[model samples]
Structures are given as C-alpha cells and as structure tokens.
Target: MSADYDLLIIGGGINGAGIARDAAGRGAKVLLVEKDDLASHTSSASTKLVHGGLRYLEHFEFRLVRESLIERERLLKIAPHIIWPLRFVLPHDKGLRPKWMLRLGLFLYDNLGGRKLLPPTRTVDLRQLPHAEILEDRLIKGFEYSDCWVEDARLVVLNAMDARERGAEIRTRTECTGLLRGDTHWTAMLHGEQGDARVTARIVINAAGPWVDGVLDNAIPGIKHQNLRLVKGSHLVFPKLYEGRHAYIFQNKDNRIVFAIPYEHDFTLVGTTDALFTGDPDKVEISSEEARYICDAINEYLSVDVTPEQAIWSYSGVRPLYEDNSGNNSTVTRDYVFELDDKDGAPPILSIFGGKITTYRKLAEHALEKIGGFEDRSWTADACLPGGDIDPARFDSFFAEKMAQYPWFDPEGVRRLLRAYGTRIDRIIGSAADAGDLGQHFGATLYEAELQYLVEEEFAASAEDVLWRRSKLGLHIDAEGQERVADWFSART
Candidate 1:
C-alpha cells in the first residue's frame, strides 16, 4: 500500500522538529505531530544553555562533551539571534573539589572540541572583582569560561517553521493515539483540536520524550522495552541576585553543580536538582524539598542568603535519560540513543531514547542516518535556522542597521524584537511608523503585530504560546496584561 507521508514523527520537542526540518530539506514527505505545543515540556524546561557539559568530564563522557562543544559553536553561528556567548563564573570552594581539579577540567574544556571563536577559560581573583562582593568572603578565586545561552522553546518553534517551509506538515496539540504497522506502511491515528484523523506513513519516528516507552507500547503492544530512566530536574527564578551579564556556577558538597544565571533582565534563574522520578510526567513539579535544596545550594556560595518564598516562578521537567544502569540519577547519560525496530518486511520504527538540547541537530543527522534511504547528505550543518541568517560576527552591525532603519521604535523594544526574530523582525514591524502603528500593546513590548505574526506564521494558537514559548514576555507582564492577551486569542479563535 502507498503511504501518505514518507516519515511520521510523533513528538514536537527539539528532536522531532529538528528531524522534520532535516528530513523535509532532504525532500521527504514528512508529518510531525505533537501531543502538546512545541517544547511544552522538557525542551522548554531546559537550563537554557548550549554548553559542553563541564561536569560530564567527571563521568568520563568525553565524546558527548566534545560533540556538544563543537555543536555549541555551530549553533551559535547558525542561530545568533537566540544563541550567544555567555561567560560562566565558577567559584573555587575550599570544601568542595580542589582548585587543581577544577583547573584541569577547565584546561581540558578549553582544548577539547577544537575551541575557537569563544574566549578560553581564565582564572580570576575574586578578591579584586565585584564577584567577590557577591560571593562569601571565604572564596577568593574563581574561573570564568564561555558557553552559549539559548531560548530553547524558540529553537523548537524555529525548527518547526523551517520544516514547514521545506514542505513538512507540523501539527501541534495533536496526539498519536495508536499505530497499526504493516509490511510496507503504518497507519497512525491522531487526535487534535480539529478531531480524530489517520495517516499512513512508511516510517514512524517516536520522539515522544518522556512518553517514549508509552508511545512504543501503544504502537506495538506488549513489546518488552526498558530504555528510559525518568529523572526530574527543577529550576527556580528569583529576583535579580547580582548585577552582571556573567552567570555563576556553584559547586555543592555532593559534587553536584547548580547555576545562577541572569534571566529576563530582572531575575536570576537558579536551577536544577536531579532526583529519581516515577509516575506521570505531566504531573511533575518542584517539591518543597527540591526548592529548599536549591536555595541551600546557592546560599552556600552567596553571601546574601535566599529563601524559597523569594522564588517568583519555578518549573520542573523530567528527562527521559537513556537507562544505562548507572547508580546515580545525575550520572545517567545525557547523550542520545536510537533503537530501530525492523523485522522481516515490517516497516521500521526508530525510537529516540535520550538527548539534550545542545546536540539536537546532530541527533537529527544521526537519526536520519539510522533510518537510511535518504539521498541528500547532511545539510543542517551549513544551513541556518529561521531568522538565523545574520552572521554571528556581524550581529552588532546588523543590530545597528536595524536601529537606524527603525529609529522610531524604542531602542530596547527593537533590541528585543531583533533578539527574538533576527532579520525576520521586519515581518513584525512592517510599515509601522511608530508604536501606535504596531497595533494593540499587550504590555511588555508585545504588540498585536507580533501576536498576529505568531498566529499566522509561527503556529502560535494561544496566549501562552506567544508569551512563554515564542518569547519570555510572560515574565515581565502582569496578570491583567496576560488576561488581555488571552482575551485577544479567545476572541480571534
């Protein structure tokens, strides 16, 4: 039987959207369905970094670190609007790992993966710097190194947009309910806002993230599978802790590390506790203990202590780490694993086990290799994502040009638009002469023009889609402003 699509991807996180973009560029008839909004879960809930995991060196994950580092450079080049360099300050704690060990790790990090473009790691005397005032008096030295920050959820949406532009079907809020596989094709049942629908595809790629096993079970009933180990990571957002563009990485007594990053212009983003998680992934939230744990971890290094009550926002995500039989939850591999199921003449099903945001494009390339039958070689390596065509080296020049072109727009508002949309800012700005021409203001520089562009071009269906995922304006807007945006979406829909 003839198939409707060449490939059917069941997930809309980074992996699925990335694969859709890659496969569609290769001329495949692709259909990607997401059970929720793109990056609604794990992808959006990342620590928002594109770094070579420095701590992974302790686990001897040199290969993953190298690949991630190399890809970090590539991603920064391709998506300069959303991904850019940020220096991380890691204070040397006398009670934790020795300074020598930290130096060795940084040295390896500097040399490994053919470092270029980004500045190399350097030792800093905390006693002389403002960081000294931020940290405890006991800490006298620190190391600062380069890593890129990412608007993670926006990355997913941009990938999906590029995929769709390349002729892939992107369906959000669409759940793959069931699958019936045949020798040459598989029929998939999907439920979404429109209603139930079925599509046949020659291949099925299950990138369901936390629900990978569940999707597999639903597709091929009773098949033995034990591939994913669910680990919950939680993050907290507090009012700005310090005044700097540089972020801080604190080392805990247990050898774990936590980050305090500048976020949303007015808040510090502190994160991530690794704890074993079971049960439904949808219900996952940061526990009181987890919040306390994060507060205590940061308080160990900071002179001004923080409490859980100070956290204005918090989020939790469950990582579907490939079960490698590792004893420690944090030690489980962040690398991706693919399990291809093809028996006799049956159609193939490639299930993505585990992956991180930094290496998503490479993961897609490798996934295509595993699926086979594509004539085109790797193209995303050189191709830019949507609105990512601006040269990384000339980003400042480009921003200046935009500033001159739209002198009527507020400088900060223009900067925000450029950061979110890059060259595509014109699509939102259009012929607008001033702020009033941009249409209704939804607070925090979110105008009706941008909202309309998101709805029409970016597949943003709700106010949350615009405020949170497409951009982080939700952090700045009040509840009343949010309600107005919601009303706008409701009225339009």
Candidate 2:
C-alpha cells in the first residue's frame, strides 16, 4: 500500500482519531492504526460527560476548565445527536464549601464559556423540588447546572468515520509493531487482517493513550520522553435505583465526588475511582476492593444504598496523564501536552500525553499545528462530523418523522437509533417493515442487522467491539445471547 502521507497516528482512541480527522480535513494525508477496534481502550470507557469538570475548580485548573467549557458548546453544535445537554444536581454539603462559595464557582463555570445553547446554573430548594425529594434529609439545598453527555465510543467512531470520509485510511485490529527511520521517511510495520505490511510516512504521531511509552520503547527504540503517567480509573453500572431524569453528584468524605446518572433506561452509571497505577494499561481491571470502594462512596451520600451484587457491569481504564508530580493523585493535571520530536529532520514524531474527550477537538488542532509547519487552513472548527448533519433544533421533529417512517420500531429503539447512529439509522434499518426484518434478535435491543452494519461500515471486528464498545447491550444480554454473537462473529471471520 502507498505510504506517502503527511501523518500517521498510533492508537485509534479519541486523541488519535480527532487528530486524524482534523489533519485530513486540512488536506493532510493521514493513516491511523489501532491495535484493537476503535475505542476498545479508554476512549469508550469514560464517565461520558462533556463538561468543565466542576471539581477542577478546587485545584484551580482554570485554563483546562475554561477550554473544556468552551469545547462543550463547540462539540454540541458539531454532534448534537450524540452530545446533548443534561442537568446535574449537586446536593449541598453544609460542611464542605459553604453555599456562597458553591454559588461563586457555579457563577464562574456558567460565564467561563461563551455560554450559548445551554441553560445556566441555578439554586434549588431541596425542600420543595422533585429532584430534592430523593436527596438525604441533611442536604437542604443544591445547585443545578448544565453539561453535555455523550455516547463516548460513538464519538470515537464518528471521528474515524469522518476521517475516512475526508480521504484518510483507518486500520483496525492493526498493531503498530515497529517504527524505523528510513532514508527519507519513517517506516511503520503494521500487522492486521492483511497480515504484516510496511508503510512509510513523513510524520508519526504517538497518540497511544496509556501505551504511549511502550510504543516508544519497543517500536522506536531509544526514543525518550519524560511526560506520560498512566493512572487507573474504574466505574460500575448498577440497576436503576432512582426515578428521575436528572443525574446526581455526591461529594465523598475524601473530597472526591461520585456520579449516579440514569443509564440504559433501566440502569445507573456510578464510578470513577482514581488510583496511581504502575502496571500495564492493557492488564488494568477493576479490583474487588476498588468496586466496593466505589459502592461504599455512593452509599455514603445517596438515599438508596447499593451493594456489589447490585452492579450489573463494571469497567476500568488507564488515563494517560502528563506527569506533573503533584502530591495528590486527585490534584494531577487533566490538561494535555504534546511532545514534538524532529531530530535532524528525520521525519517528525509527535507524542501526545494528556487529554479528555471534551477537549479532543482542540487538542487535535494543536497537535497538527506542531506536526507540520505548513498545511491547509484549519477546517474542523466548523466542519460537522459524519452523521452529525441533523439540525439540533429539529431533533424532536426529525425523530418523530423517523418513528412515523418505521412505525414498527419501538420508541426506545428509535431513540437509541437516533442517539447512536444519528441521521444514518435509515441506512442501518433500511426499509425493514417489522422487527423480524431487522434480522436475528440477540436479546435486549441488539439485532443482527445493527451488528452487521457496525462490522461492515464502522470497523467493528470482535464480539467485545460489538457488545462493549459499539453498544452497552452486554449489561442486558444473557450468556446465551453473548455466545450466539461470539459464534456468529467467529464464523463470519
């Protein structure tokens, strides 16, 4: 295959895909290689909120906070279907920060960004509102604010899809095994469906998230960088415990917060335990202790107590943060930094260290600016990602029209189709007249047609890619259904 390109990105996570999409849109020929399916790593496994982390205000990360807030507005415009506004209720802790202080922080968060399209924060009386009824009696007041929630994995896929649409090549199940500096270009060895292939590129980007250091040590020997630090974070999905559409944010005694958000219409997502890690990112898993820790944290603040047995699913991922040597793990930086190496003009290699999903767009723009001295003007700022063509204001009407078009489709199914696939649901379901026409049912909301479309169009290769990354049906499907999917995928390959 042709190797003449301006950029080659390692890791198909958000940062790599984002950079690939941005670079390709700017007339830069780009090739992205992922060891597994897109977002099989940390990209898909996130708390899945696009916000200026409210807690970051404590650490005084003003720059990251402001940038993230601005990007929230930007990403909402670009991918309205996948990223939509949600109101978070933070129950006031009488002892934590005082009411006036919380109000001041909310004021800063609301006005930090351009503040368009989403409602501003407001104080709520816990004694009278429905949202307040669920809170513990000790919490007498709270603050409600706006933030965008996203289908994390789909965001990664849409970036790759958009990159492909812009003439970029994306290789899944392709591991970058070797990197060597050629006479004039950098040669990268890729092993995948076509077997091993040697490709050449003018620049190589190491956006390999948690595996950035390993890629450098093995693929490009002797490459030294003093940036990345992989910290493990874990989350748990439990049976729905409350009955409101609003999400809750509870402050822990240790000063960290846990979120309990409505998930899958019948479940809640609670998580995120941050602990320093020194093992292989690939081997990271949520330990029993970590799971219990999260469960206990939630039980300490919420009205309903949750136990480990109540958890339906749990996931863990390593955040590839830039080493800041902060005294506390929670105080470490969430902002990203890029390391651009161009020794003796022997094909530039840029290594990305820390980033969050909310700011991936801006991170990509900045990464490309350093990858090359000259390129087409930045075009991704206003460019809509693939399938993000629906007007934000018309989402309700458009969804209504789709329901009319496929009257047999369940309303929940229609909403999922629109949220996950955007305006492209028509392509997946096609002209199917009934549920039977959608193909074999694998339990819950999964069907053979959607699986096939994911594999055929979105680069899904394995069962985990379908069950965990592409969708969260694993939480609902039984062992038999999983076996059927595994058998089907194995037989197809």
Candidate 3:
C-alpha cells in the first residue's frame, strides 16, 4: 500500500508524537510510525517531572530553562488531569553548592519566564515544615518549589490521539525498515502485522530518540555524523518510604541529584544514574551496580536506608543526547539540536537530538519551523492534547466531583483514574453507575472498562503495552493477575 503525505515521522516517543500533533493540527498530511507502542522506550521511563531543569541553572542554560519553565505551566493547563503541580523539598546540603548559590538559583527560577500560576519558590525551615520531618537531622534549611508531574507515557498517547483526531495516520508496531530519496519525495518501507507497505512523503523526520543514528545509517546510508552521544539513565521503584505528599531532591556525594517521589499510589519512584552507554538501546538494562549506586544515593540523605532487595522494579533507558563533548554525563546540555540535509534539492530529512520531557511541545514547534519551506506554519501551542480540556484551576474541583460521583470507589482508586484519564474518565467509566459497571478487575485500578478503552482508542497492542506503558498497573498487579489479563487479551484479540 502506498500513501502520499506531507510529513512522515519516525519514533512514537514524546518528540515524534508531539511533532505529529503539531504538524497535523496545522493541516499537514502526516503519518507517524512506531516500532513499538507509543512511549515504550525512554519517554515512559523518565523521572517524569515537567520542571525548568533547576539544576541547569548552574550551567547557565538560561534559554532552555526559561522555555522549559513556560512549557511546564502550559502543559499543566493543557493536561490538567495527567499533569499537575508537584512540590519538591530540596533539603539543604552544605557540601554541595552553597546555600547562597542555591538561593540565587531559586530566586531566578521563581522569576524566570514571567512566572505565573505556580507558586513561587520559598525558603523552608526544615524544623518547621511538616514535610521535612522525615529528613535526616543534618538537613535544617531547605527550599520548596513547584514543578509538574506527568503520566509520561500517557502524554505521548494523548498527543498521538489528538493528532489522529486531526487526521494524522499513526501506525503502531510498524517497523520503518528503510528510506530512499526519489526526486522530490522520500519513500519509507514499514513492516507490520499487515505485511510490508510503502509511504511516500515530502519530508522525513528522524525523531528516533536513541536510534536516530541507526536510522540514518540504515535508512539514509552514506550520511556521516559526529554529533550525538548516548547516555543511559536508570530508575528504581520501591515501597513507599515517606508519608508526605511532596517529593524529595537529594544531593548525592558525586554531585548528581536523586529524586524520591510518590509513584503509582503505594510505591516511591527513585532514580536515576547517568553514565555513557555503548550498547543497543533495546538491550539496555538496570545493572546490579546501577541499582546499588541508586540505593546508596538515596540512603545518603535519608534517615532510613534503602537496599537492593527493597527495589521492587527498575528500568533503564538511553538518552539520545546531542554530543557537546562534555566530560560528565550530567553536565551535557539537555537542549535539542536539528540537522536538516537537503543536497541536490531532494526532500529534506530532519533529525532531532537531545530533549527533555518538559520541552517536547516547543521542540516540535521549532523542529517544524526548521523543516524548511515545504511544511506549513506551526500551530501546537494553543491546541490541547486529548483529555487536557479542563482549566488548570478547576482540576481539584473536577477531581472532587469524580470522588462525589463514585462514592463507592476507594478514594485512592478515584484519584488514580482522575490522574490517569483526567477529563476522559467519563469515557472510561461510561454510565456504569457503580463500581461493578467498570467490568472485570484484574488488580489495583485495572478495571476492564479502562483496559478496553486503551486497546480500542490508544492502540494498546499487548498486555505489556497496557500494564507498563499506558498505565503503571504492572507494578500493582500480581503475576497471577498479569497472566490472567494476558490470557484474556490473547483470547479476545
């Protein structure tokens, strides 16, 4: 099968999906193909904070910091249900950066990008604030600041769903085997369950995260590049450690910061260690040493100790960083760069590298801007992603209403659905009128209605796609529950 489109995007991660949504909203004929489920890779495995990159302030990445800050607020408004405000308690550590320097950074972080909506950063006396009570006695002074937490994988699906709503063609589990230039167009081959198909497009975008270089090597052979680095980052999940709703930013002895945040209700998500990677992205795993390193980092600041056995789950993903030749993995620029090659007047191929979850939307807009004269103007800033319709200010009230409507649902369960589906809960729950109406419950919040919704609307092709990526129910659902769900999915599909 052959279809002509204005733009063809590779990789269905945040950047690719974001670009697809932006291009499609602008009325471009768009096709996006993902080798796996959307956000099955680094996107879903992120620490999931929509921050201005507070640490980047030390590096003086002012522009990136400001843009990310603005986007953080914008995303909160756009996806009120999935993305919401999170307060981080950064305990003071005299050994690392000094208090004055940290204070200056916070002051700048507070005023940067015409601060609005989110509360400004404030100095916290660890002795006075109840949130800091869990910290070790050595930490007395701290800073509390605002950032947004995201359902990272859901964000990708929302963008793709929104793009499809605007007429973009999204192919999941479709491998883009090759690309070839032909006069004024590029032909891309994709293999999937339906067998091989070809699509011709005016422009090809290589947003293939960790595999961008590989795509160029295989799809557009003879292209040379010396400007990308792959850095592997790993995170671990353990049983909930602290009772407070806020998160912690701990300063490790090695100069990297570790985050311990509330995750998936009963778990605390902590991570990540950054190191240069030398293997395939698909083969990357959380090594035993990485787990030990992460646990040691968390144990450094907390009164309680975390061990390897305590880590219930862990994952590793490689960041396709734009190589600046920085000596340290943590010091590399988080900003993105674009490479457009258009020799002999053929259709151009644009490749993207190095981006954070916070800056994906803007990255898409800018990537399209640099797509040269072939594409239309940008239009994603004002567009709302799927289920992002609620006004940011009203999310609390909306959540309250959901709790009131489903009085039978446990408070935790209601909040989980609201946080995951946002304004789309009505679609998931429908008019069931009670808890039983949600269909078979696999475990935790894995109701049949929601799982079916994901498969039907969000392109959930497998049980892993539903359990791990679309939702983090994999951590809550027992092995037996997972087997049952897998069996049910196989029988039905």
**Candidate 2 lDDT tens digits, 1-493:** 4457778899999999999898888788889999988998889889999999888998898899999999998898889889888899888887777788888889999998879889999888877667544666777888999998998998999999999988999998899999987756788888997899988998889999988877777646765655677778898988887887888888888888888888888998998988888887778888888899998987766767778888878889999899999877777899998877687777778888989999999999888777655474877767777678888778999899998999888888888888888888988899898999989899887888998899888998878888888788787789999999998899986
How much lDDT does each candidate structure score? 0.93, 0.86, 0.87
Who wins the lDDT comparison?
1
- lDDT tens readout by residue for model 1, 402-428: 999999888888889999999999999
For model 3, give the 10-residue run with minimal summed lDDT. Answer: 372-381
Q: List the residue pairs that clash in candidate 2.
A: none
State the TM-score for model 1. 0.99
Flag regions of model 1 displaced more than 4 Å.
Answer: none
Misplaced by over 4 Å in model 3 are 1-3, 129-133, 224-226, 374-377
- TM-scores, one per candidate: 0.99, 0.96, 0.96
Indicate the worst ten consecutive residues by lDDT in candidate 2.
Answer: 218-227
What is the clash count for each candidate, in the order shown? 0, 0, 0
